[model samples]
Target: MSNHARELAGIIMNRFDAFYRRFLDITLGAKVRFESKDWLGVQLAGRQRIRLYDHHVNETLQAVRDHMGGAPLGQEGLKALKQAFNDRLTEHANPEIAESFYNSVYRRSLRHHNIRAENLYVHGFIRRATDPDLTPYCWQYRTNTGALGDCLRQVLERLQLAVPFSDLTRDLGYVDRYLQDHGPAELRGGEIGLTFVNTLFYRNKGAYLIGRLEQGGLQWPFILPILHDDQGGLNLDTLILSKDDASILFGFARAYFMVWCPVPALLVHFLRSLLPNKADYELYTAIGCQKHGKTEFHRDFLNHLHQSRDQFELAPGIKGMVMSVFTLPSFDVVFKVIKDRFTPPKEVNHETVKAKYRLVKQHDRVGRMADTLEFTNFELPLHRISPMLLAELQQVAPSLLSIKGDTLVIRHLYSERRMTPLNIYLEHATDEAVQDAIDEYANAIKQLAAANIFPGDMLFKNFGVTRHGRVIFYDYDEIAYMTECHFRDIPKARYPEDELSAEPWYSVGPSDIFPEEFATFLLSSPRIREAFKQQHNDLFTAGYWRQLQQNIEAGCFVDVFPYRRRQRFRFLYQQGNDKPGDGASPP
Candidate 1:
């Protein structure tokens, strides 16, 4: 402590005693008969006890205004005190109990928000009369005013800043600038990190602290306690003006709190020898949150209230080994939250996000997914599809998707885009329709291959035939360029052990593929099997896909006409066999 600052603190403390004596006489009054509460030497006498507490609070503020001129404890200090008081007003376990010793203000005026009864000293403002170990008739609590006289007495003790309140909000801006200048990794290197008592949003009343931060080098293990306040995402501009003045507060608050409890940064440092590590923002928070559970472990009622069995979520995704089949009819359109990792779905790869750019040049038959949305988790983009856009499915092999803005809204599922999974729809489809669908499926594959696309998963589930008998591939998790894949022959078993092994004998990398595997996958049923064998026999060998891949890679452009031959204008009109200038045939 600097000599100059220590002298200012002493001046404030000396003046507190006289002011406390005067304030107590006013709130308690000259002639008021008290009830028989053993602790206070007299108990509280009134029915509207809560209102009287409010009255005492108002008087305390008024007294400060009367005695303490806008000098050391300016509006910022007073505001801090008020915010702390209001926080404690409603949530005290024992509102009546008070300090062990009394100067009229300590026992009669100043109120402590909470108390710990189990301790031998009964830590907090609780009087000896309320302590069972100290007194016999300690059942009913009477006093709430603890050591709160310090609010008026030692005003600038908590604030270790330049005097005269030249800049009430300078420290706040400093904290914000320090954080913005240094990333979380840099803060762990003996750097001081600042955290809010509550969040630093619009109605920010709680104080902030500057303390040393410690984080592990590996996996970035967050050593700082999960300070709900640290994640407020506020900036220096918040202290000035914000368009966000509409929403008042974010975190939970208690009932009728009146007094404030702002823990100073210096006091935090003073106790360093006993508690050396930075105040795990989560430590006091954990002690404060004995009533509820953290978000990951306890999903509250809102999670269940918004979900319905009727709603369908049709966006597709896979996280490593686990697959999220969002396009299924049984899908739930609710926003998914992934804890411990990124909360929302991250785009898996670069090409997946870039596909949208290439999609604009593709013909209509090359079905499109929802609009691509970029997320912070991955450098690529993921599809964000809306159920409302499903209305356009039949019209355009259809989908509606927006990438920007809050992508968490749940839209009502429409019937068209809610078409059953291709394999399931095939189960009840007519045999002729099944054959037509399989034929269209073959055409779609051949056309896509010619256009430099390869649907890595060639299962029936990935393709769906429209009512007009055109097959489209909607699943894109495993999609790739035709040139990037290797279509290889399944190696024959070279040793006896290979034949008996459960897995394949050949060494297969991620890009290595066997096109012959498509034959059995396409031949899942007898009718489709017979039809495919007769009509698309070439698809059974590795050579067919490889040839198509090579042709496309060699720059052989394949014209994918969307309309039928008869639907073309030239097909509808007859051309004369004569040279130019000959009259055209009538339509």
Candidate 2:
């Protein structure tokens, strides 16, 4: 035999000896004797010695080969077969003591392989070969003869071949070639097994010194001694800790169990890494009513917030209150641990606290007030402009912000201060400025309409301006379909005729609505209106609105007024002023 084959044979022999000894101990309640010449001999305490014949070793090897799909035995396969042989020997010698051993192996193997309950192929084979349905005797056989038999049968079936010594050798050769070509380099090392912890830290982390330990790589500093011995073999659980304390004593347990451990330790570690010795943000709480649900909805929302606390940097606060409906008695609110800190406005005094916004009880008996609080600043013309304005416009500069469900999260901006659309004209003295602003705003509404988004509470107070002067829509409750929108030629009186009421609210189709009047409602100022008509007269014409209405109804979903769609102009205006090139600036 070649050196590798000799090594393999030695490993097989050592495994057999261990199995034989363990079997003797369990069955006969005595240790087995071994001859140096590959001979296995067993003895009962009060009985004559029983010399193990070659048939026993031959049969076990055959069974193991059969179990491994007739493939050559890898280190893991060899270890398992050795364990099975020991179990079987114990069972045959003393069936009474064999039950526990058998059960332990059976349960472990079943769990390790994730064998489903519906896998009747193996179960059926065992049932046909044994009595009492193989269920009661499953444990005893599993430890000893049964595990080997099952493995052999499974391997043979997997290979779709007859069970024989010759076929087993042939299959092993095939498996050897397959592994030689395709197996990972690390796995090619003799008698070594791959594990995530070892590979992750050693190979990927470039920690070559630690890699030499192989399986010991997973034995972290605190967990090594309990797992290994002076001879370097693993020490079983019984020798390490008592059954009750075994779970508590282990430092690095299974991956799933490690995940289940409390997150506070990791959280602290992360915080320490980011801002060592510095104080962290305090938690804050906000309360509001569900648009169309009960307290359960509110509870679920709180749970979601708690689970994503790390993402939000939220700290803990009070329980607040639970409400059946949005009312004064049932409403509750809590403050976050962190203080609301923002840069003070340039005009504000350093020592004075500016009351920029207010947080109030959701159910306070304010007139026409909903449970939600309005976040605003008086310096910005938010109330006079649009309620659903962009975040950038509300501040001093432009910013990109998005709404996560009900909460607005600003991002990709240096500061929260946004520039309003009105501010765009305040600094410049362009003649067609007001007309340009109206056109931009009109185009924004048209885009929203084309997307089937009907702003139910479409009012100036609801919109905001970004630093870039682009309008942004934020409110979700009143967001609906353009198809559900209705427009009147003139403002409707408080007491309108019943003929104006559209019935079967859900039956409204996209084709039934007209959105051209949106420009009139949106640009209500007379000065701005006159400017829009003068500069863009076609904007107010019926043909323009009609064509827009047709495009929206057709559901093209394209932007009606994209920034790139603006008409190119050579000069600001033709006011016969001797300004260089007659108002035409050089490109």
Candidate 3:
């Protein structure tokens, strides 16, 4: 390799290492933020950390340009550069991440339009699953060697949290009861041992201690949510023993976690072991590597095309006026393109739609809004798209799509995890299921509100139900911040003529919102109306929204537990104080 290529590689690696250290520095503050109750600082740190990748990428690109003395790299030069880069990764801890960083620099600096294997790392060099040197980043505990409670105690102590556990013995009893009641036979028989990731994951008010219990063939994942009490002590909020619960905690709807990961690839690998069904992109994004997650997702998508025969069709839901959505039957994601013109009653423009999505990306999702991956000039095979879907896209968003021989190119679009539209799910669901979904839908609205988001369109069609039966809002074209909205009540008509008018008698501002009118459209079905009113009648009142806005404006951070309230340890064992040895038995 030429000295320029090797020197460029060295400079890139140095920049990446600096970026990684800064990332870790921000993550390291999570514990101190939690200890000192700096909720606002935590939120700011999350937003700032998200922008670091792009900042470092731009910096690295400049450094590479200066090193090349403004000379463009030809095909041979690019190959030499790539090879030199690969050689530098022989025994590196985060080879895949560094490759992703290099790809960003190559693409942005070179103004690269096409994805070429020679110039960029379209496919990762590291085979993570089979890599022998992927060091173990977790602590192992053999339960059969000692009592389970003792092992749990040791695991808690390993975290070395700034605040002490308020009642370790009581929390242990709670964990024991959960294991006895919910665990598989292996857990009760002392056959399963625990393997905890060495780092604690911090998000919002919670610091999660995540691990998996396995004994030969049987494996069960768990997450222990550690929360700080108002006092200078910590408490075990809950014991999450189910894979479903663990997945929810790491769901796409939630904000990214801040965890110390020396080798992010190793951490992602460890998480994938616990969550075999979770995609590599999701695992990376969960651990705060969203830029790399985008790279992984592109690779996964390309691989899926080779492995499946399914064609892309219109996503199964009511058509979105501002966006056209399509999905491949065999794939778990949907691609959305902004329409050339929105339909009536949808007043948002293209830029407005993009701004709303960006707001969702920057704001705390609060586990109620699905995250989207934005892409530019994305391509798909024309033959793979169904005729109807293609026609629909042409009619709705022709300006966004173009054809180059067999390929259909989208100038800009977003890809998101597909879920069953809540309206569609409710239509086919049983009575009991409908009731459960209604409750969940209401909770989703409340949670989004508490996070300062107002889903401007609260219809069932705007929301989707994940496979885990959780309701998450996906349509972002009409979303607004709760603080920006003016919650209002419908005023009484001043005259009989006013009551008969087609439009509202009261003058409304652009930001004015009548909460009472939400029910007129959302609760049209009698069963849904009854069920929604049973648990969330307050949601229909202006006061409910106004109070939330007030709290948000006052800088109050609401606690929205990922798990069910019934699963909370404090709720489960309410009889005793945090003082241990209070003679409290498991309820």
Candidate 4:
């Protein structure tokens, strides 16, 4: 490879490497140790790694499916799996779909062989093909017969041409040679586990990021923290798999591609122009300021608002999580800055950033989120911020945002509502307050779900009571749509091993959601819990979620009125015909 190519390759690799550690921490609950470039140590201390028999890719698939409680190619599972794949294909073709696709792929690979779908696999042959003779070697994994090759054919049918098994094999050999001379074998303690591959030839389509974690199975089942991006801001939008049934394959096919291809030729001209000037920051600017091409009036107002609030001070909100609310002495609009780093980037947690943006943008439409100012960054030079406000923010939301060096900047969310957190109000309870709280909470949940949104964490702190006494969800980090979540009944642990194990016996897919836990999680005290049970106990069952999901899927809109049931018109809501209560109230 030429010097230009090598440099471009390094730049490409660096972009992917940025999120590698964070991905491991969030997805696999593991850590990474960079011993050297070649040998990376993925510490598996904080996770569950089950062992598998040698060369049992199919069995591992069954085990993984069982762990996630997914039926193995059962009618429903097959439908869901196919939908998942087709979802990606559609997203690639067009971006108008409302449902944000998070493609998470898992690989249960073998030697030179790579398996993508249950029936889709990739294989490599050692000898290069010339002219028209692209025959596979006998050593090739199950070629021209059975499920493996048939699977590869399925994938090949989708691509332009069948990639020769030898092209990959020849390039992989180049990587091995490079590593033999300049490798981290010694520093890795020969423990990076590269001695054998189930297959010798495996190639993957789509973008490759770094290995995020190490799940220590008897043998590795794909690489943990393996992230795939199919053009969604380099987010972990898709999970790609490389499964093979072969032996003596090295660490990664991507590594070899980088070593051999180097510049990729095409990107060099583009990358070179940026080299003379520090154009990388232009890319960083693109990421950080994605919502704005250049600063508009409103955006500039938000990005530079701190400068104007000189003598006027604001007090931080008390007793809450997920947001740092500051009270304006003017006492109207409170500043709600998403404490910097309050949520992981979408690359790790799929739609967190998108969810937040949705909540703010749709606040009025959903009749929820306190009318918000544009989501922007708060920039307060270290010298400008008041000591009292800083100390208060630190006390209430220590992790909300932070000050680095001489500057403090964080994602800001300014809202016009001067509402108290419902949890705080509940601390000094009243019958009226309790009734309103219960009614508003239920109303918000139903309305949001009706709008296809689910606040994944339904904690009291996440909800607020507007001065007019309506409860609305303010926190959006864990928010997701009702359609995306797969509500399920918890699977009972059958085996003693499963019961005793800390990790779940059943498989936990990324979208698997258990509505059964909501009752205990949302309703706090016994009184509040019983109150919720009296009104909305159905929330604790899978049936309710399933029906609601079905209803939404069937093009039904279940509108939830914002007013309390007690306050509704007598005709709109009556408690067992008990004189239907008060005034000309309407829901």
lDDT of 4 by residue, 322-342 (tens): 455665453344566544334
lDDT (Cα atoms) of all candidates against the true structure: 0.35, 0.28, 0.85, 0.39
Taking every candidate in turn, the Cα RMSD to the unseen true structure, in Å, is 30.8, 31.6, 3.9, 26.7
RMSD of 4: 26.7
Candidate 4 ranges beyond 4 A from true positions: 1-323, 343-351, 359-364, 375-384, 391-413, 495-501, 562-587
The ten-residue window of minimal lDDT in model 1 covers 242-251
Per-residue lDDT of 143 in model 2: 19
Residue-level lDDT of model 3, residues 209-230, one tens digit each, is 9988887777888778988775
Estimated TM-score for each candidate: 0.34, 0.23, 0.94, 0.40
Tell me the RMSD of model 2 versus the true structure.
Answer: 31.6
- Best candidate, lDDT: 3
Best by TM-score: 3
lDDT of 2 by residue, 199-248 (tens): 11100001110101122232111011111122332221111111112222
Could you give the candidate ranking by lDDT, starting with the highest? 3, 4, 1, 2
Give the Cα error of residue 16 in candidate 2, in Å.
44
- lDDT, candidate 3, residue 587? 19
Instruction: Tell me the deviation in Å of residue 99 in model 2.
Output: 46
Clashing pairs in 3: none
TM-score of 4: 0.40
